[model samples]
Target chain A: MSTGAAEAAWQPSELELSRRSVRRRASTRSVVIALISTVVFAGVIGLALVGSPGWAVVQQTFFNLEIGIESFPAILAGLWVNIQVLVVAAIGVAVFGTLLAVLRSLRGPVFFPLRALATGYTDLFRGMPLLIVLYLVGFGIPVLDIFPRLPAVVWGTIAIILTYSAYVAEVLRAGMEAVHPSQRMAARSLGLTHAQTLRIVVIPQGIRKVVPALMNDFVSMQKDVGLISVLGAVDAVRAAQIEVAQSFNFTPYVVAGLLFVAISWPMIRLTDWASARLAAREQSGGVV
Target chain B: MTVLEVRGVRKRFGDHDVLQGVDLELDAHEVVVLIGASGSGKSTLLRTINLLERVDDGQILLGGDDITDPGVDADRVRARIGVVFQHFNLFPHLRIIDNVTLAARRVHGMPKDTAHARGLELLGSLGLGAKALDYPDRLSGGQQQRVAIVRAIMTDPELLLLDEITSALDPQLIGEVLDLVRQLKSTGSTILMATHEMSFAREVADRVVFMQGGRIVESGPPEQLFDAPVEPATAEFLARVRHH
Candidate 1:
């Protein structure tokens, strides 16, 4: 008990203090060098871009601040549509993707047909380009008159959900497969049914192992939601198209691109931070 | 009464026949220890009995019930048996008490309060009561193995299968885990255990079964099997193991 007080009172030797300062100074020097090099790099790139022969035309078309300011409100209104679609699509992906992953993981011959179907579904969706899927689903479904004519956004949302769940399910399957077989054996030996083992033991560990990967898909999903514009949803991309048609300036498209980047940047940073924490925890080899 | 009857079981993985027409039986309250070299099929036999593995050919009777039939519910059969593994496969996300009591509450439909009480008391008797709230990763290897034992016995299974439980522990930690097994044996739990520790086998087993190359070479009471082996392979194995 007394050792705690003694340990707390202990101090570094002079040599240890010098080593600490040496490490601190080395990091500070690197930071300063990086800042100088980055500024110089940007300056060179800027000068080259400005010195190009068509700079005047490019600026008038793509960097028109007046047009960007004028189109900002409409683009912002359309962004609300993109946000709503992203939220709904994300929930659908989590549920449908997990069900697909569980199906793929089934063990016996009795589940072979289901396993094959789920596998084929993922392969078809993941391999097909998203643009083609959007066009086919967007234009194709209404022709069948599947129900009373619905808004194009509903079809567009369905297309995105179908494609993205393939991706999410694969990531989750990788995570589930990474879980050691012994865990499953232990759960089964304890008399838990296969479904019970998956719910209580396997899937929880699987999801944890792939949190960073899941976050990457989530960030990618935010941008793809804008693809709904192709179906004439008047989402941000569509709103930007209107401004571009009226003024014949490409500035609104650039504005829309920057808006997408603005929303996605925080999630990108979060994914990196999560990846770092996961890596650190995994290196310790004891984290559940 | 015979607690388990494994009749002419066979298992194959790739070209290797892991269990080659093996037969084994354990009577109620009989502590049988299986001694074998690596890949001798002892562990495979235990796994098949628990239905963690499917046998290519055989019938496994647990208390006269034909458990190997395709129509038989494997989960309900497994509920009547307890098993511990070499690596102490405790559920990593759960607390020690949750790991101990999960089967009792989930599989058997024991109420949460009653299961918790039973789990805590068992952990207490095993010197692990204070560590109940901690995760398995937080415990030392010996402590984790003890918790695994508690998890195994929580349901009072008709038979217990221990597959090299002490093989993964440090030398200093092995005694604590073996002591718990000794306690289980004294309490008359019908146990079929596989072990590499020859000395512990001598001390704890009522009967010793020697297996070689996927077949039971010989078996008898511990003294007769260890001291006066009838099979040349059995004596050769004992000599080689003891020489090490």
Candidate 2:
């Protein structure tokens, strides 16, 4: 009798069902809004160019463009200059970055001020836009008579080193910090000097972790060589700019863009592949 | 001869005191186990002996030399006293063989071949020779801790300070590490360990010292401390930890 009475009293509550339905509708509205925005963005881009001369000219110059077999030599020459700039600047940054990182991480008397100075240097360069840094180094420094006889190409190279070293130092610092405090304790307990422990253990692990980041930084520096055009340095971008200036046509700008893409494409793809490989190895138990 | 002495050791962080007026001594070839609650300053004391922690106020002596003296060369003294931490702070970047051989070659000026051979031999004794080329992460917690001990002993320090070396191991694996420590007792090496394994302490330690609130509340032969502790605090601590 009691079970039958309970069954008679049972009824589906409409308020609870209605509240759940309201939440579902609200969530669907948000998703709908998001999708509508994406479509609207595409529509805006499509409409914005329909009557403009920019895209037509871009398409005509880029699609119909072809460098003669003779012009290939000049393109190759520019490519070589880009390679040289990247290699030299990367080497300089490696040596300079390691020295600065070590000094920053050190303790005791001499290192404190050096740490501050290195930190200030990293911050000053990193905070400034790369173009501004290039401009300052390339044109402004010569006015001060420091490295007065140095070529514009040398000044551009210096700008790359200054900007990239700041980034590399932070990468190196993260690697160093990843080493556990207990390892330092164990080293000290073994009666090994601070320098000895750093040289043998901490630095090796740190260098390994920072390798990918360093490579990525190097790639960015390679691309930034494009900015050396402002100094009239004869890199790939400058070569294209000079060619475009003579003809008053925008084809060389597109060609310069293509050159950048050519150089950066392989580097980007290689870093991506390297990162994936590293990630796979890490998942399989490679040390960080 | 007294191998280690700590007098009026007091350590504080901010307004809180971690160790208060602590005094301790370790004789030659003695195996002392320091038992205490977490944060009782037992680990702090051991670290201070290695100069890994600078004591706020105290004097520490090793083999009649004042290690706490401002003029003393801490690195030289540390070379004579090896310490193994709870976490086997092995250099993860280096192979197990390199981790063990590095200090021997760098600090003691041992040739690479000699250091490599000794490292292999030590690994063999620990039953870890197969993993000598592997990184620290590849080894189990117990295996890594054992490797840490070998790395420390490769330096051949006169005294070894083991700070809760087996505390991090799984219960089943704790036995193997403690067994290695028990076997080490027979090697005539002076050892001071901060351990949670009560039965292991009774088995291996020549003397058992119970500490609470950063002071040695009671200490005696392992039999007496384990069987009928004189202090209530010691008895209470043993009762709490004996179940584990």
Candidate 3:
């Protein structure tokens, strides 16, 4: 670290330093301009909002600081339940969807029944609304007295798996089918069997192609985990409901909504970033 | 001796006939270049020869065996032929040397060490030895195509089908791949190639076959065909290609 004088490459030339300084100054100026514009626009909107006639009543009901603070602990605790359900449901959807995709991908007249069944399952579940599935599974399973009366959270997780797996399976199948027939020919020409070709060559490439689409589904799933609160699960939304009832104010609901935005916004941005990166990678191949 | 004979080969995709009763032949150590517009069925003809596309009606004789016969094993027939595609079609995930050796080792049962030795030697000769451990995408487009040529030939198939191998390359990169093909030709590998490069065909090909509407319109020595094309379609195609 002390050998700076010996390190000839460490010094940039005067002209180079001047060029870099101009670029840096331009960047700093743009940052200042952007900050000024954003603050001015936000200030205008804030003044308009506060200047409205209903501000006093609206603020007392929806923006009560005391109620929001009091309900934060319960809402955070309930989010832990959503996280557990999300983890289990994500694994379930991946395993079940892949199996269904494999079943659908089987060739020959002999496996027509399996293909038809897998196709029918994806069509049926993808068509059904997630809320209705939750209601039916949440209510119907308990009525059947299945396995000593499972909790609503368990049933909600199951319902999510049933619905989301259909989406995942379809995405995966599209990926597999989109793998060019030429690639198969290339593999088979090397004397690989149809099954061996799919395993070794086709499936891996297929999964790679649809990774961006798969990440979109993952981001969507994070938002829908909030819906589990409807099935009498003490998840964030339900916890907010209990808090709002006790306080007789809308601030608790606002807290829950903001918490969800905070949790899922970064993932939504991440999916967008990944999609752009994948498109770039496809165009110019390097580390995929 | 005839290495390949295509007799009355016809292939149809839906309502459009891709190959309309075509016949051609190639001898040992000979180079036949197919030149035509994009949809003239030269690529489809190559695919049918390698058994990637089934012929609607025809006979293809590879070394006196009727390969187009329904009972013939397609994979076995394909293994006996080498193909270099326009897009370089290299397996992106595999290292350059692995791509070269995979088919030779898997289908021909060549031992790993033997295949690797040959692979490295061939790559080294082509100026790709230092890149042996890198994946296909890491190399330039021209280099990847050279690697593909290596993959196609390292197995030493009886016949080689090059389907528009340089069409997908950049203008500057095209020469690198063409040079490799020229090198392959000097080594006496029998090749049936499809290309848009008229000059390369004139220089390397024993015969140039011109096609129009899935039919071979004319065929002769490159000098006879390119300089004194008998068919109007052939002359017009040549004029258009030269204008470009």
Candidate 4:
């Protein structure tokens, strides 16, 4: 009888209904506060910019919709060059960087020379500024009559691959080291040759662990592919420069910059999504 | 027949000798358990046999073959022995069935279909059939350890080395793993294990070897070692473990 009475009393009463409304109100209040803050932040920034003395001149020079639309076709064409260089250099760097990392990680006295060579390559390339390397390889190689007829764009791509591979190799090496020593032991004890262990077990895990880092490099590479315009490769930035010189308007530069961001934005989102997924997979407890 | 023999094995890390002239042997169908305190060279001895550690001075004979010879193929020798580590080191990226079939397929060059079928059969018999497609991280510690055992025995290795396999498991999960080891023993598999579970050792080991200060103090049948240890060091070790 007492249990039945307690069950009867557990039904939604006026007090419980009031408590539910209180919780709902608290959530609604937070959302309202957030919306107000966002609107105020945007309004203040917009008002200050519009009230500036040079607003009209700045807007006419850099934000002219008519000039932006006119330059879009040429800028889009130039962006194709950037995409090609990025795609080619991305593949080149992955292959070259993995080889360098493996060479550096080899054991025994027999590998000392190869290890030293790999280390020297990474140090030399990583120490020099990418711009300096690009200038030397892009301009100097032609003067030396080595591959004299090769296009400047090809030389620029090579320079990018050489510099970026060093950074990527270091990233890969760190990933390999981060794998616990026990993993190597587990693989080796399975009767796998050292090379087989690396190929089948260690390298795959290392590459997976460093995917976000690799994607970050690729995003940065997308912008640096523009650096090739210094070699007279006629990429987006160079095309934008040509437009600005002819029209005396900077709107073309803005269009080109927006294109770069448009390309990289999805990649950044992808990196975030991948990192979150990996974290969630790791944190989920095992099944019983 | 004597399947594995270790003679005058010595290993040193810097100036400290980890395994000081240790000698041991395993027959074709026997279980030898090593029990010792931490830093007593139990793990080092096991690693030396698998050639993960090169002994400073010793010879390990596997079926009359001198495996420690400089010219011997280490990979070929390792294929004949199985090992299970303390932490159930299953590859996190692989499915449970793939982990079991890896050595059979890659090292032994078994056909893919044959390897997978054998792997599934082993998992099914072990009550892990439903988990064959699940990733290692999706299995419990006990289940992962069992999968490791299944992987180790996939190729019918001549000797199995189990290094504190149950040490990292929870008390509740330890029984399941120990039960698998007992089952393997019943099938006449030769096993050499290092463990800290004294009662389990007493129950499962045909012979118990006690070590201290990088040396085997005493070894005999479990009845003699557990009930009446001959060496003072063995008695002291047993007393401390029993008190806990």
Per-candidate TM equals 0.93, 0.85, 0.76, 0.93
Compared with the true structure, the alpha-carbon lDDT of candidate 4 equals 0.93
What lDDT is reached at residue B189 by model 2?
A: 88
Model 1 alpha-carbon drift over 4 Å, by segment: A1-6, A51-53, A285-288
Q: After superposition, how far is residue A285 of candidate 2 from its true place, in Å?
A: 10
Per-candidate clashes, comma-separated: 0, 0, 0, 0
Kindly report the root-mean-square deviation of model 1 from the true structure over all alpha carbons: 2.6
lDDT, residue B212, model 1 = 89
Task: Sort all candidates by TM-score, best to worst.
Answer: 1, 4, 2, 3
Q: After superposition, how far is residue A196 of candidate 4 from its true place, in Å?
A: 1.6
Question: Model 1, range A1-288, lDDT digits (tens) per residue?
Answer: 899999999999999999999999999999999999999999999999999999999999999999999999999999989999999999999999999999998989999999999999999999999988999999998999867898888989999999999999999999999999999999999999999999999999999999999999999999999999999998999999999999999999999999999989999999999998878876877555
Please list the residue runs of candidate 2 whose C-alpha ends up more than 4 Å from where it truly belongs after superposition: A1-56, A68-70, A140-148, A277-288
Residue A259, model 2: lDDT of 70
Q: Please give the lDDT score at residue B31 for candidate 2.
A: 99
TM-score on 0 to 1 scale for chain A of candidate 4? 0.88
Candidate 4 per-residue C-alpha lDDT over A1-288 given as tens digits, one digit per residue, 9 for 90 to 100: 999999988879899999999999999999999999999999999999999999999999999999999998999999999999999999999999999999989999999999999999999999999999999999888888757588878999999999999999998988888778888898888899989888878888888899889889888998999999999998999999999998899999999999999999999999999987877767786553
Could you arrange the candidates by DockQ from highest to lowest? 1, 4, 2, 3
